[model samples]
Target: MELIQVSHNEMAALFTRPSHIYNSVGFALLNAPKADSVEFLTFRDTRLRGGLILGMCGAMARSPFSAPFGGLLLTREQTAGAVEDMYLLAAQFAAGRGMALRVTLPPPFIGPGLYAKSVNVLQRLSGGCATVEINYHVDLRGVTDPVELYSRSAREKLRQARSHDCRFERLETTPEAIARVYDVIHRNRLHRGFPHNMALEQIVATSAVVPMDLFMLTVDGTPAAAAQVHRLNHEMAQVVYWGDLPEAQYARPMNLLPLEIYKYYLAHTPVRILDIGHSTDGGIINRGLCDYKESVGCRATPKPTFTVNLRREI
Candidate 1:
């Protein structure tokens, strides 16, 4: 097998589909900002027989109080032993950098048990160099009826909105609207003490795959919340960045946005599953955030994020 740097054209082809994990857009955004450091290790034809994409950000700040931060990304494939091959490439890449690595593994559409097994294999390969940061996932397929899917509190919130004569519009993205959505996302990251992924212009450029309508969420003719969704594959969709303002918080636009977009995906997109990004049980440190996602018929499933301490190795 061979490892090579993947160009934008290559990623464009590989990350074309809906993904529960390993977003192409995210990769694109990261590389645009840190093109020199961010590396993509890709596997070619081999006897082990599978392909994997590993995202690496080099020379990043390592926290003395905690494991260093890096990025992990993998594409979904049908091969059962692919995880091992992926880990082999990742370990070599991480060890060479002499920096701690952080891996965020989201639940794959193949189901939870197999995902667990793959995690075990990856752990074995990365060895002392690796540790899991968190596991984030949820199962929303349990509720057959959309109405019955909501929790009691969520139902009440929807009812309250109904009492106020509220309505939802899943807006499409235009050149002008993409910047607005990015503004909401900027606020979200600022409040969370995180950096924005890319400049607003770059965000608009990579949003070609994100449905125009689902990018913006409005309440009663006012812009309330916005999020970008990407299809993982034929069967799943990933909820990427989401942002809401203080004024819209009272309207609960964040909560309602998913339901509307989900319903739209259910009706139009071929995705049978949805990955709602981070949650608290997955070590996200935000109980309210976790609870809010769960209220919309999401059940936590286990998918691990890993970290490694490499500065001590030498």
Candidate 2:
């Protein structure tokens, strides 16, 4: 097999079906300005296998230019051997260009076999993993009400949230509405002493291209909590950002917000799982925050980031 650089249009077409939004065309546009440059490279011989659109940072080629994690996206059904060869050839390309390789992959549930093989191959090439973060997701298959799996503590919090007159509605993803919701997220982040990494304009621009939805939890007709959801693919969705208003914390809208989100995916779309995003800062686990997610029917998966010096033996 050979590693070849393909046109942007060709890469876009192959990644069109059931691929992560972070690697899609919309994200490519958003990712371009953030990087020095970007390129599309894939493995090809008789047929095109898997590849990645990397954003260049000096001599380092990073897979995810925008979101949490994205490495090699498979374009067709291929074997484990083929997957390993793709990674090997990708490293060769990087070495030829005098570049390094840095790829971070999402949770394995997105593609079980592919992710497993990727992790093994990346580890072998790099000699070890770079970092691993705990990512949370709510499994939605073969279920209706998400509360059935919630812990008693979480259930009580949901009950308290329900005692107040609350409403959950999916907002129209207009630029104005996105800014309004983003302000709430910004406020919550500030209150909690966390940096807001993404800007309002990026979300608005991405919403125009990808399938983005806004959902809100209103108590007594007042906004208490809101969440920005992104459909990673037809089968998976992610809660990009979600938080409760500072004053609304007394109502525990955070609990109810996630529950409503789970039901929305179960009832409204082809999606079978809802990624709750990460509760980690770097590789450090936020125990308190992560425990709370588990209480609300979420499971943790190790999302790994791999790095290799292409100039070395790899």
Candidate 3:
């Protein structure tokens, strides 16, 4: 088996279409923006094996991250043994440089066997690394009806929007509209008590990998709300980097935007599932965020976040 470092475009192609989480695309997107330097390692036992595209930093030290790197895409056949290849390759790649291997995987609570093996391999490679995971999935083959898929509250929100003359329009990602979308997401994060780490440069870089569209809910001519639509391998549509303008809050465009996007995917795109991305945990520990998502039509599904201590060294 041989491990090789692929170029940004190659890694982007591998990740932009594969079944792995969108974070992979985010990595390539943020690689140049956040980090002073970047390297993309692609493992190949036969096809693309397993490896990480990490940023260049000093002494493999841990730094606060806005999001995790993407999950490695490995076929069921190549899952085993291939992990060792990745570890050794990454180590060598960071050799002399003394950098830690930090991999962030976003998988469903119930992932394929290869997924579990990945965690086991990462543990074997690193001694210590910060980790976190958010569980969200795409049901590509089932659940396409927006109305049927929506919970009662979600349906009601759409109805309410129509009653209020809230109009929905899907826009293409263009330079002119980029800042507008960013402003909405920026304001939303502020309202939700989170910072906007997804800078414009990263957003533009990331959008270059996969096909992207913008969904907007408008009042008259101004943009009230928007969500970036990432078309994933024709199977799923990822609702990523969303935000609502302050005025949108009063207009309740948050509730309306999702339904419009859902309906658009159902009618125009070949997407079978839509991943709403991050949600607060429900169960004994309930959060308003999770509650809000649930009210709009999300059900609690099993998801996991993992961490590895780099000092441990697999």
lDDT of each: 0.55, 0.84, 0.61
Model 1, poorest ten-residue lDDT window? 61-70
TM-score of 1: 0.71
- Badly placed stretches (over 4 Å) of model 1 are 1-33, 37-48, 54-56, 59-82, 93-102, 110-114, 127-144, 184-198, 209-217, 280-284, 308-314
Quote the lDDT for 190 in model 3: 88
Top-TM-score structure, candidate number: 2
Q: Which candidate do you rate higher for TM-score, 1 or 3?
A: 3
Q: Residue 42 lDDT in model 3?
A: 73
Better of 1 and 2 by TM-score: 2
Worst window of 10 by summed lDDT in candidate 3:
60-69
Instruction: Report the lDDT tens digits of candidate 2 across residue range 1-314.
Output: 98878888888887776468887765786668888888888787787787787888888888886678887777666788998898888777777778878889989888888889889999998889578889999888888677897999899998999899999988898998898789888888899888888788878888877799898888998888888988888889898888988999999999999888888877878998889888887799899989988999999998988887778654
* 2 versus 3: better TM-score goes to: 2
Clashes of 2: 0
Best by lDDT: 2
Ranking by TM-score: 2, 3, 1
Q: Give the alpha carbon lDDT tens digit for every residue of 113-190 in model 1.
A: 446655676566446344332323334454445657789989888765555434555556676767777787788778
